[model samples]
Target: MPGVEREPEGAGSARRSLAALLLSMGVSAAFAVAFIVVVGLDPGITFALLAALLVSAASAYRVLFGSPRRAGGITVGRTVMAGALATLVVFGAIQAIPHGRDHTNPPVVSEPAWDSPRTRELAAAACFLCHSNETRWPGYTNVAPVSWALTDHILTARDTFNFSAWEEFPTSARLIEAAIRDGRMPPWNFRLLHPEARLSAAEKEELIAGIRATLGG
Candidate 1:
């Protein structure tokens, strides 16, 4: 250890390294923001980024500042074993939960009214743009950060209310009405890409009627 020579931070090298780091950080942050904006601009991407950063920072701190003795305690073998056991426990707990019971109730209509084929068609067309249970819109769902959030929204929305399985939701009418009235259902960014999904005044009315009929309102 005494003979080891530490590399000195030369002025030019230090400046170049700092500049490169700053540039990289700026580019990463910009990409993150742009990706999120392209998505719904909802709280999802921001929250996920915050969570990832926090976890990353914590891991970095542990790696950089933790005592060597403690670090040694977590040997590769022990780490693998711990990870395996944790995964097993998680899988077991998940298996114990009843199928579909882990999720919230699917959207439903209270009473059945005259079924409007138009409304069902429109809802299927619009909702599937983002909430498609089988296939999502091309290229949209694959982008990073944006994909992260969109994937979550898609899964949650599909679980709560999948238009493909429209008849299953119990409060389908109320959900449809709220989604239209609040202008939150179609998702603003989704409209930008697929204008067809954007609901017009007449379309919204028809959609509401359809939802009402389905729910027996």
Candidate 2:
């Protein structure tokens, strides 16, 4: 083994750098996705932001360092790492946005004189949460954006035909009956969480009939 010239260690170093670079980029992408999801952005926006992050980071890496055939992996790794940090910054910015945190339920003025206690009971189970002042705020209702949309919806529903306010006879009786008949009163989203609010065909008919009866229709 006297002066047998060995090939330099350049290729091995480059291979290791490439491996580390790929690992960093994969981790960055995962964090960006998780961050976007956990912050509660809808799928469309989340995907858009993710694509932007990856493309921008990739382009930046390519600009700073030439083709991967060279030792460009180090530059790629740095750019992806920066992208992950940028996602965290975006999360913080979203959290700082104001509005959609009100969790108060106003006092019940007077309830409707229902045709029967069963009618009131059914309404309580299915509709009163949003349509009355007796709303039971769940944990997610406290979160932003969701809270914003839900509160707005609740306010609008209450305005439509609030059992809490209780006028002489609600003009919404026909609309309410129609919605219940069509399986839209409680809403699928509401039933998803409160299974008790789920209505059967027979029960829907009963609710519709009772609402019409209550309104003297």
Candidate 3:
């Protein structure tokens, strides 16, 4: 009888809590949408709202039921082993791919001048900041959705112009100069974070000179 009497009030309390939670979620979603809009991020407000909801749910769960403390040694060991295995698998797959047909036989420019030390260094200093397999500043680059964008951009840029395989492309010195001068290459947003990649007036002149020298212009 005592338990039965408490059931009705318990149900009412649960309903009230759910209503409050939902209201709070709604307000949080609205705020996220507004913030994303103000920031001018692509994909609009829905992405931000969803991200906020996920974070809120995680926080609520953690608060209601405390998270288990990690056994640091075991966790670190497991992570290191997983990373090593993944690296080996990736390396093996890359090595197994047909290098001749997939790489060597691809359409190439075949200009020795394109592979000159000056040209390679210039590409590394300027283009590789956002378009190479080797990334320099990579702390925030590993974080979730932002990492996704960075990875996609870098991969796409590399596919378009792989500096290591530049001799294969029908690239010309003029094309390179024009791409850099017009601010079409290296991308605007990428330059925002890597200001050193932003070509200075003097550096741009030097780059153009180097390209012209290579092309015998």
Candidate 4:
């Protein structure tokens, strides 16, 4: 070929930017997926985590493509990346604590003499996972902090009133009736995750009435 003007070496930076941008996106996306898998659906903490992730991603984008001005001795981009890396390390280390990964469902020694089959069905559908021996642990319950929270909640619920262990039922029936009637049995967060626990007006009424009849309100 005839001698022609060669492209400048700086032109390679464009290709570098493109590759780095894709890598940034891939890393961010992978972190997001892993975060959810590890932390489950805690709205507050998740939102904060995502906000930091967004800031880190934005800073990375600016460094890769936009003009990243030096602020102090180091740039803000590196600071954010360092903070995020530290957070990941701390969370990763938390997994080794082994506090709440116990998915043990003790034997169903007894059960309440449910007023009717429908009552039992309703209870099982809405409240059993946390309040009974037959809990079907979800995937998030296998992780660390999320597992800890869920395990604590479930244990507390069972202690309060376990339908599967009705042999030791230790509360007044009025408490049960009030819990259902006041729309407090299924907390908002639980309903957010469990659609079946989102009872309709009629269903709630029926369940409430059934609990009273079964437990002697």
Which predicted model would earn the best TM-score? 4
Instruction: Tell me each candidate's TM-score.
Output: 0.50, 0.61, 0.48, 0.66
* Model 4, total clashes: 0
How many clashing pairs per prediction, in order?
12, 0, 2, 0
What digit string (tens of lDDT, one per residue) describes model 2 on residues 95-199? 565655666787888886689999888888898988898998888776544565567678888887788877622456778877877776787666877898997
Judged by whole-model lDDT over C-alpha atoms, candidate 1 comes out at 0.56
Question: Following a full C-alpha superposition, what root-mean-square deviation does model 2 have from the true structure?
Answer: 8.2
Scanning candidate 1 in windows of ten residues, the lowest lDDT window is 97-106
By descending lDDT, how would the candidates be arranged? 4, 2, 1, 3
lDDT by residue (23-62, candidate 3, tens digit) is 5567556645543443223455346535545555545434
- Score candidate 3 by TM-score against the native: 0.48
Off by over 4 Å in 2: 1-92
User: Which stretches in model 4 have alpha-carbon errors above 4 Å?
Assistant: 1-76
Which scores better on TM-score, 3 or 4? 4
The residue pairs found clashing in candidate 2 are none
Top-lDDT structure, candidate number: 4
Clashing pairs in 3: 108-168, 109-168
Per-residue lDDT tens digits for candidate 1, residues 157-180, read 766765545456334577668888
Residues 22-110 of candidate 4: C-alpha lDDT, one tens digit per residue:
66567666766654543344555555655665665556545644553333123434545654665565567668978788888998978
**Model 2 — TM-score against the truth?**
0.61
- Candidates sorted by TM-score, descending order? 4, 2, 1, 3
In order, what lDDT does every prediction score? Answer: 0.56, 0.69, 0.53, 0.71
